[model samples]
Target: MSQIPPPRRRRALGCGIAATAVALVGIVPTAIVFVLASAMDPNYGWLLFITLPIAVFFGSVALVLGVIGIAFALTDRGGYAWPIVGIALGAAQLIPAAALLTG
Candidate 1:
């Protein structure tokens, strides 16, 4: 008799999705604000205050979670697209943060 196949696991997909969402939250709004404000004023240096906390604190979380989630996804045969996106976004957040420090 033929046996049924096991169900595909998605145990870590939620983690991946959450990582992506958090990364987005840390960066997208800040980007939108700068993009909008740059058109009106040449100086918006104070916004670095907002970027610093999110980048230093939450960006690291998203990066670590994304890596862990991707590993879990691979082992569990879950989709990894979100985790990859999350990692990229998390890493991207560091650029502006480093710029803030130096410039």
Candidate 2:
């Protein structure tokens, strides 16, 4: 017989997926902006101010969601593969944004 998953497991999984999606949404646009900025003339450098803030905002959101997802996943007996993935993706989003801001 197949075993059914618990409610908490489902919630954790949902949160994990949401976090991963958020991170991807944050990263993709920033990547595109970065590439475009690099390819274009130096005069448009001012655009970084606009794109960077948006990317940072999304990155922060992803990080928060990923942390919450990880916390929820850790409380259950089920595997936390998705939450781990979410955390990784969230970090991926944050690192580039931080680097852009700092550098």
Candidate 3:
């Protein structure tokens, strides 16, 4: 049997972890929004609740991709920093979204 290359293994692992993190980004914000909406104002809060999940999902993808890209870069592979920057911006948006939904 041919042994797999080390670099390929690292990339695969990094990609998997990054993907999982990206997926989780949606769940966290959505759960937060849902709970807050349910408690404070389930009726109209429902409408405003839409943005949180979408933002989290995309934002998380950016963040995870950034971190993974950085790691890959450090290992000699190149990647753009857009995902990292995107995550930072998205993080800022989360605060306001939470405030609107809860407070």
Best by TM-score: 1
TM-scores, one per candidate: 0.77, 0.70, 0.40
lDDT of 1 by residue, 1-103 (tens): 9999988777578778888888888887677668766886657657757766766666778898899889999899878888888888888887766887799
Error of 3 at 53 (Å): 2.0
- Order the candidate numbers by TM-score, best to worst: 1, 2, 3
Candidate with the larger TM-score of 2 and 3: 2
Best by lDDT: 1
lDDT of 2: 0.72
State the local distance difference test value for candidate 3. 0.58
Tell me the tens digit of each residue's lDDT in model 2 across 36-84.
7689766666766676666667767777777787787777655577767
**Where's the lowest-lDDT run of ten residues in candidate 2?**
5-14
Candidate 3 backbone collisions, by pair: none
lDDT of 3 by residue, 1-103 (tens): 9987765335534554565456456556666766778887776466545756586556656566656655665675544344345455546555665677797
Q: How accurate is candidate 1 locally (lDDT)?
A: 0.79
Cα lDDT, model 2, residue 103? 100
Q: Rate residue 26 of model 1 by lDDT.
A: 84
What's the lDDT for residue 81 in model 3?
Answer: 48
